[model samples]
Target: MYRISVDSSRCQGHARCMAFAPEAFDFDDEGYAFVPDGMAETAELSESIRRAEANCPERAVKIEEA
Candidate 1:
């Protein structure tokens, strides 16, 4: 399985992940990307995470096998 993690400290509120995967990422009131519940098990979650990680200019998103 793949584990997705986002380092909020590194996030710049750019919303790049939201554009790549709206279902997996949502913007908080401050415009920071946050992952809602059940996102890890979604069928398209992995792809979404991958896209987000790749597209993140701040390199705050990461994916790892667990």
Candidate 2:
């Protein structure tokens, strides 16, 4: 499995990650991107997820082996 998260400090509310991986990311109240609770762990290494990571301008999207 893999763990996904967004570094809130680095995120600039660009929403690129949401565009790429809507199923895996959501925005907080202030419009910053975040991985919803319990949804961080993913069993599949989806192409959209990789695209989201690559497309994030702020480099806030994080994916790590779980």
Candidate 3:
């Protein structure tokens, strides 16, 4: 299994990750990407998480096996 992680310290709040995968990433009031607690495991969400990790401009998102 793969887990998605975001390093908020490096996030630029560009929202590109959210645009690429809204289901995998949520934008806070300030437009930072946030992953919900349980959405990581759904089959519908895995590709989106990968896409988000790939498209993050800051390279702040990552997916690793659990």
Candidate 4:
């Protein structure tokens, strides 16, 4: 499995992460991106997660093995 998170401090609300992986991320009231608690990771989702990480202009998306 993988643990995904976003660095709110670094996120600029560009939403590129959401664009790439909407199923893996959600937005706060202020528009910062967050990974919802206990999201399931599938092989397809992992691929999208990598794209989201790569596309983040602020480099806010984080992925770690769980």
Per-structure clash totals for the candidates: 0, 0, 0, 0
Clash pairs (backbone) in predicted model 3: none
Task: Quote each prediction's TM-score.
Answer: 0.78, 0.94, 0.78, 0.85
Q: In lDDT terms, how accurate is model 1?
A: 0.76
RMSD of each candidate relative to the true structure: 2.1, 0.8, 2.2, 2.1
Per lDDT, what order, best first? 2, 4, 1, 3
Which tens-of-lDDT digit does each residue in 21-59 have in candidate 4?
Answer: 888889899988888886644433468789999999888
Q: Which rank order by TM-score, best down to worst?
A: 2, 4, 1, 3
The number of residue pairs in model 3 that clash at the backbone is 0
Superposition error at 43 for model 4 (Å): 8.2
Alpha-carbon lDDT of model 4: 0.83
Residue 17 lDDT in candidate 1: 88
C-alpha lDDT of all candidate models, in order? 0.76, 0.93, 0.75, 0.83
Worst 10 residues of 1 by lDDT: 37-46
Which has the greatest TM-score? 2
lDDT per residue for candidate 1 within 5-61, as digits (tens), equals: 678899889888888887777767987876776665443345656888899999988
lDDT per residue (tens digit) for residues 1-66 in model 3: 667767889888888888778777776788777778875544343666677778888999877666
User: Which 10 successive residues of model 2 have the least lDDT summed?
Assistant: 36-45
The collision pairs in model 1 are none
Candidates 1 and 2: which is better by TM-score? 2
Error of 4 at 56 (Å): 0.3
